[model samples]
Target: MKLSEGVEAAIHCATLLAQLEEGRTMPASALAEYHGLSPSYLLKHLKTLTAARILESVSGPHGGYRLARSADAITLLDVVLAIEGPQPAFRCAEIRQRGPGALEPEVYAAPCNINAAMLRAEQAYRAELRKTRLSDVISDYLGEADPRALAFSCAFVARNQRPQG
Candidate 1:
C-alpha cells in the first residue's frame, strides 16, 4: 500500500526539529524549501504534528517550531499517525457476506480467515513501525554520513532556515 507524501514530510520535519538545540526553532517554510515541498502543504503537515504534541509552534519575531519532547520520545508511528490519522491501511469489508452464492450460516457466523490473516499482517506492520523512534532513525542517518558531510548538511539547514513570525 502506498503511504501519503504527508507521512514522509512529517517524518522529515520531525527529524529536522530533533536536530535543533532545545530552544531553537525551524520554520515550516525552511523545511519546505529544504525538501522542495510546498510551504502551504508542509504547514498543514506541521499542524498535524503540533496537534499530536510532537512539535510545538512558537509565535513572534523569533518564533517558529520546536520539539515538544525529546526526540527519543517521538516515534515514526507518531509522526505517521499525526499526518495520516490512526486508521488501518487495510480494511476488511466482509465480502463473504455478499453475493447470491454467499456463505452458509456456519461460515458467515465465523470471522473470515482472510480477514484474520490480513489483520495479523497489519498488526505486525504497525508493531514494526512502533519500534522505530525519530532518534533511532536520525542516529542511523548521522552514523552513515561522513563527519564533514553531516556537519555541512546541518549548517546548510541552519543557514537556510527563515525567521518565523
Candidate 2:
C-alpha cells in the first residue's frame, strides 16, 4: 500500500512544529524550505492538518502555525489520516462477484480469503502505526544525532525560516 507524498510532508511538518516552543508559530514557507518542499503544496498539506485539528493556524504579522496539542498526544495515524483521509489503503472490489466462474448466491455470501488476508494486513499496519507517536519519532531521531549537530540543524531551520507576511 503506497501512501501519498502529502502524508510524508505533513508528518515531517507536524514533527517540526512539535519541536518549537509552545505558542510559537512556524510559517508554511519555512516548513517547506526546511524540507526542500514546495511552499504551495506544503500549505495544502498544512490545511489538512488544520482541518484535523492536529495543527492550528494564527493570522497576523507574527502569526503562522503551531501544533494544536502535545506531540505525544498525536499518533502517526493521526498525521497520516490528516493528510490522506481515513480511507483504508486496501480496497476490495469484490472480484469474486464477477468473472466467468462466479460463485452462486449462497456461496458468494462468504468472505473470500483474499479479502480476509488484506484486512488482517491492514489491521496490523494500523496497529503498528498507532503504537508510534510523533514524540517517539522525534526522540528516536534526536537520540542518534550529536547534540551540536542537532542544535545546528534547529538553528539553521530557524535562521532560514521566513515569517509569513
Candidate 3:
C-alpha cells in the first residue's frame, strides 16, 4: 500500500506538535515551514486530522493547532486513516470473476484466495500502525537522536511557535 505525501506530512506534524508544552499550539505556517512543506497543502491534511478529532484547531489571535488528546491516545493508524480515509488499500475488484478466463458462476462458491490474502496483509499492516503512537515514535527517536540536537529542536519550536499574533 502506497501512502500519500499528505499522510507522511500529517504524521510528522502531529508528532512535532506532541513535543510542545501543554496548551501550546503551533500555527500551520510554522509547522509547514518546519517541515519544508507548503502551508496550503499541509493545511488540507491538517483539516482532516482536526475533523477526525485527533487534533484541535484554535481560532483568534495566537490561534493554531495542538493535539486534541494525548499522543499515546493517537496512533499512527489514526493519522493515516484521517488523511487516507477508511477505504481498504486493496479493494477486491473480483477480477477472477471477469474476462475470458472467468469461471462458471456456480464454480465460484469459495472466497477469492487472492482477495483474502491481500485483506490479511492489509490487516497486519494496520495492526502494526495501531500498535505505534506519536509519543512512542518520539520516545524511540529521542533514544537514537543526539541529545543536543533534540534539545535545540525543542527550543527552536518553542521559541518560534508562539500563537499567531
Candidate 4:
C-alpha cells in the first residue's frame, strides 16, 4: 500500500524535533529547508501532527514545534496516523457481490476471504510501525549515517532550534 509524501516529511521533522533538548523547538521553515521541502507543504503536515498530539506547537518569535512526549514514546505509527489518518490502506469495495455470477446477499453473508486477508496484512503492517519509535529511528540513523552527513545535520539543528521561556 502506498502512503502519502507527507508521512515522510512528518517523520523527518519529528525526528529533528526529537534532537532538541527540553523546552526547545524548531521552526517549520527550518524543517522545510532541512528537507528541501516547501515551507507551506511541510507546515500542513506539521499542523496535522500537532492535532494528533504527536507534536506540540509553540507560537511567537521563539516558537515552532516540540514533541508532545519523549522521542521513545512516539511511535512511527503515531506519525503515520497523524499524517495518513487511521484508515486501513486496503479498503474492500465488496465487488464480489456484483456481476453476472453474483450470488444472493444471504449467500455471501460470510466475510470475503480476500478482504479478511487484506485486513490481516494491514494489521501486520501497522504492528511493525508501532514497534518503531522515533528514538530507535534516530539511533539507527546515527549509527549508520556518514560522519560528515551526521555532522551537517547536527549543525543545522543547533543553528535553527530555539529555546522557549
Q: Candidate 1: misplaced stretches above 4 Å?
A: 103-106, 146-149, 160-165
How does candidate 1 fare on TM-score?
Answer: 0.89
Residue-level lDDT tens digits of model 2 in 49-86: 99899999988877778889999999998988778778
| Most accurate candidate by lDDT | 4
lDDT of 4 at 29: 91
- Name every residue pair that clashes in candidate 3: none
Regions of model 3 farther than 4 Å from truth: 163-165
Better of 1 and 3 by lDDT: 3
Q: Which ten residues in a row have the lowest lDDT in candidate 3?
A: 156-165
Candidate 1 C-alpha lDDT tens digits along 1-165: 779999998887888878776577877788888789999999988887898899999877777888899988988888878887888887888777789988677778877899888889878888888999889999999879799878876896678544444
- Give the per-residue lDDT of model 3 (tens digit) for 28-138: 998888889999999998899999999999887778999999998999999999988998899987778899988898888889899899989999999999999888998
TM-score pick, better of 3 and 4: 4
True lDDT of residue 69, candidate 3: 97
- Which clashing pairs does model 2 show? none
Q: Candidate 2, TM-score vs. the true structure?
A: 0.90
Assess the local accuracy of residue 24 in candidate 3 as a C-alpha lDDT between 0 and 100: 79
* Clashing residue pairs in candidate 1 (N, C-alpha, C atoms within 3 angstroms): none
Question: Evaluated with TM-score, which candidate comes out highest?
Answer: 4
Ranking by TM-score: 4, 3, 2, 1
**Whose lDDT is higher: candidate 2's or candidate 3's?**
3
> What C-alpha lDDT values do all the predictions have?
0.82, 0.84, 0.88, 0.92
